[model samples]
Target: MIQDLRGANACDADGCDRALTEPQLVFETDAGRREAYECPCGAVTITVARPESSR
Candidate 1:
């Protein structure tokens, strides 16, 4: 789980920061798998694929 110490985007008035929570989901595709995190500001950040050995 992700932690939000400053109430999700404490720096901005709209509270659209992506670092406030964990990624929405972990997906596996033909190309690879990644964790997707989205913010209220329409910013989507995808982490690199996890190692197959770990999965």
Candidate 2:
């Protein structure tokens, strides 16, 4: 099964299991894109994706 991982969220630093704010576009290219999600509790999560053509 193909799961959509982009919907995943970073847990808060307090361990409350709260979702972080929307991710910001940190980088991008013809090959892929990068995003950053920051929690008020100072937790940060970065995600990267590459197009199938880039493989």
Poorly placed runs, candidate 2 (over 4 Å) = 1-14
- Candidate 2 structure quality by residue, lDDT tens digits, 1-55: 0123334544646665666556754687896877777666767777777877877
Candidate 2 lDDT score relative to the true structure = 0.62
* Model 1: per-residue Cα lDDT over 1-55, one tens digit each: 1233223533232655334366677787766666666666776655565456766
lDDT scores for all predictions? 0.54, 0.62
Cα lDDT of candidate 1 equals 0.54
Cα error, residue 41 of model 2, in Å, equals 0.7
RMSD of 2: 3.6
State the number of backbone clashes in model 2: 0
Cα deviation in Å at residue 19, candidate 2? 1.1
Q: Which numbered prediction scores highest in TM-score against the true structure?
A: 2
